[model samples]
Every structure is written in structure tokens, then in C-alpha cells.
Target: MGIELITLLIVVALLGLMAFGVPLGITTLTVSLVTAILCFGERAGFFIVAANVSEVLHKYELIAVPFFVFMANVLERSGIAKSLFDSMAIAGGRFRGSVGVQTCIVAVLLAAMSGIMGGEIVMLGLIALPQMLRLGYDKKLSIGIICAAGALATLIPPSVVLIVYGLAAQVSITKLFAASAVPGLLLASLYITYILVRVRLRPGMAPIYDIPETGYPFFKRLKFLKGIILPAVLTFTVLGVIYSGIATVTEAAAIGAVGALVVAGVRKEACSSP
Candidate 1:
């Protein structure tokens, strides 16, 4: 068959498989394998497929993905996200849409620490979503904020997406992370600014997050900042090692995983102590 016809057939096959509800990964793998077998003999096709898979598997930077993912899970289950949310809320003080703004900040911090979108979104949904709702914020606003802010994980430093891309494109992961940092923060700043402006104009879209702690003097609330310490340390450790040239991206990722476990252990001990 002509190459054009073969390409069209492969596209059609992919869509058809997806329409039938096959997972994207499986569908792509199946189509590629079938195409290879048809283009080359069975033995040659299998060899090509194995070689490609093995090549990807052997990439050193690819190792970062699981380590980052594990760190995300550890932080998720450790109750650190909840603490970060609470601390940021109290630290933000009384203001219209304060919870929403705090949620955005927490999302950025979480993104910095984890670099995984699903985990960041899940953490926000579980911890921040209900709080925003209970505070009388608009339903659509709350959901939108969580989703938009959580997606920063894809752009922020130490992002697994960038790691994989760097490996595939043969680019520098460090430079990619540095290049993305400003854009990610700028997006976050925009989210916060929008929240502040929206609530200021609408007045009813987001209620002020009022509580006893919020009533405290601003400086006195500084103690609540303790909640962010571990996340900050972990972020510093991972990014610091990478940017300082002390370790490669994969090694930094391994450090992050270990730091996550240590943070979890410390939090568990603290909770169990009293």
C-alpha cells in the first residue's frame, strides 16, 4: 500500500479503537504493532517493537517519572496538603475570596513540590473544594480555580512532562525547567489576580473566609506558617540539587522521593505525638 494510504488507515484505526472505548495507550500500541508487522515481516516487526520499547525504558531521565509520582502520592496521603491549605488560609487573613486565593497559592506550592497534575488536582478537590463551597463561594468558581491552578504542575519546575519531553527531544531538562518557571508563575499570578478582581466586583461570588484565626493580628498568624515548612524544604532540595549541578535530574528525583518519605514520617510522628 502507498505510504499515504497506510497513514490514513492507521489514523482511522486509532479513532475506531478509541470509539470502541479501548484505552489510548493500548490502542496506539496495538496499531503500531500491527503496522510494523504489515510493513516488515513478523520477526523484523517484533524486533523493531522490542527495540523501541527497550530504548525508551533504558533512558536514565525516564526514571524520574516514577520517583516524582511516588513523591506526589506520599505527600497526598501524608495530610500535608491539608495542612498547607489550612495554613495558607489562615495566613491570608480576612478578605473577599480569600479562600479562593489561598487555594490558588496552595495549588502553586503543591505543584512546585509534586510536579504531577492528577495528584495536585485530587489534593485540591479533596481539601480545598469543599471548604470553598462551605464558605459560600460560587460553585463554578471553586471548581474552575482548582482545575486551573492544579494544572500548573505541567509547567512548573521539576515537571514530569518536561522531563519526558527533554529525554525524547534530547534537550537539557534543567534549561527546560528554568524556561518554564516564569511562565508557570505568571499564570498563577493571573489566576490570583482574577480571583481578587472578580470577588471585588461581584462581592457575592465569594464570601469572606472568616474565622477566629483570621481575626488574629497579621503578625501573630505567622506561627501558622509552620505548615508550609516541609513542602518548602522538599522543593528546595529537589530543585536546588538540580539547578546547582549537584545531581542529574534522575538523581534529584530520587532525592525528592526520599525527602517525601521523610516528610511523611515526620508528619506522622507529630500527629501521633499529641
Candidate 2:
């Protein structure tokens, strides 16, 4: 068959399989295997498929993705997100839309640690969303902040998406991380600026976050920094090792996973103490 006709048939088959509700991954794999067997004999086709799968499995950078994912899960279960939220909220003080602004800040920190959007969004939704609502922030504003901030994971350093792209394109993951860092923070800054502007234009959209701790002076609020120190240390440890050339992305991800467990252990110990 002509290559053009083959391509057309593949597209039609994919669409038909998807329409029938076959999972995308399974459908694509099945179609590719069948196509290979038709084009080459069965033995060669199976060997080709196995070789391709083995090649992907052997990419060192690919290991980072799962390590980062595991780190995210560990941090999530350890209650670090709640701590970061509480610290940022109190440290930011009583400005209008302070909670939303702090949510953005917390999201950035979470993205730095996790490098996964879904987990960060879930953490914010579980922790920040209700707090904003309780403080009488507008629902749309609250939801928008969570979503926009959560997506920063995809652009931040140690991003799983970037790792996969680097492996596929044969580029340096470190360079990709470096290129994305500024853009990610820029987006975060835009989010913060929008929240502040929106609240200024319509004060009722975000009631000032009021609590006794917020009434404290800036110097007094330094103690709240304790809540964020572990996360900052973990992020710095992982990214520092990568950027400083002390480790590759996979090694840094392993470090991050271990660091997460240590942080969780420390938190657990502190809670149980006294």
C-alpha cells in the first residue's frame, strides 16, 4: 500500500477505535502492532515493538518523572501543602485578596516541589479553595486562582513534561528547565498582579483575610516562616543539585523523593513530640 493510503487507514482506525470507547493508549498500541505485523512478518514485527519499548524504558531521564510523581504524593500525604498555605496566608498579612495572592505563592512552591499540575491543583483545591470561600472571596476568583496557579507545574524546573520532551527530542533537560523557570515565575507574577488589581477594582470580590495573627507586626510574623522552611529547603536541595551539576535530573528526582520522606518524618516527629 502507498504510504499516504496507509496513513489514512491508520487515522480512520484510530478514530473508529476511540469512537467505540477503546482507551487511547491501548488502541494506539494495538493498531501499531497490527500495522507492523502486516508490513513485516510476525517475528520481525514483534521484535520491532519490543525493541522500541525497551529503548524507551532505557532512557535515564525518564526515571525522573516517576520520582517526581512519588515525591508529590509523599509531600501531599505529609500535610506540607496545608502548612505552606497557613504560613503564606499569615505572613502576607491583611491586604485585600491576600489569601488569593498567597495561594499563588503557595502554588509556586508546590509546583517547584511536585512538577505535576494535577497534584498541585488537588492540593490547592483541598486546602486553599475552602479557605478563600470561608473568607468570603468570590467563587470565580477563588477557582480561577487555583487552576491558573496549579498549572505552573508544567513550566517550572523539574517538570515531568519537560523531562519527557527532553528524552524524546534528545535535548538537555537542564537547559529546558533553565529556559522555563523565568516564564513560569512570570506567569505566577501575572496571576498575583491580576488578583490584586481585581480586588482593588471590586473590593467585595475578595474580603480582607482577617485573623489575630495577621494583626501582628511584620517582625513578629517571622515565626510563621517555620511552616515554609522545610519545603524551601527541599526545593532548593533538589534544584540546587541539578543546577550546580552535582547530579543529573534523575538523581535530583531521587534526592527529592528521599527529601520528601525525611520532611514527612520530621513533621511526624515534631507533631508527636511533647
Worst 10 residues of 2 by lDDT: 52-61
Candidate 1 lDDT by residue in tens digits, 126-185: 999999999899999999999999999999988988998888788999999999999999
Over 1-274, each residue of candidate 2 has an lDDT whose tens digit, in order, gives 9999999999999999999999988998998899899889799998898898898789977989899999999999989889889999998998999999999999999999999988999999999999999989899999999999999999998899899888878899999999999999999999999999999999999998889999999999989979899999999999999999999999999999999999999998987899
Once fitted onto the true fold, the runs of candidate 1 whose alpha carbons sit more than 4 angstroms away are: 1-24, 27-50
Clashing pairs in 1: none
RMSD of each: 3.1, 3.9
Q: Estimate the lDDT of model 1.
A: 0.93
| Highest-scoring model, TM-score | 1
Clashes of each: 0, 0
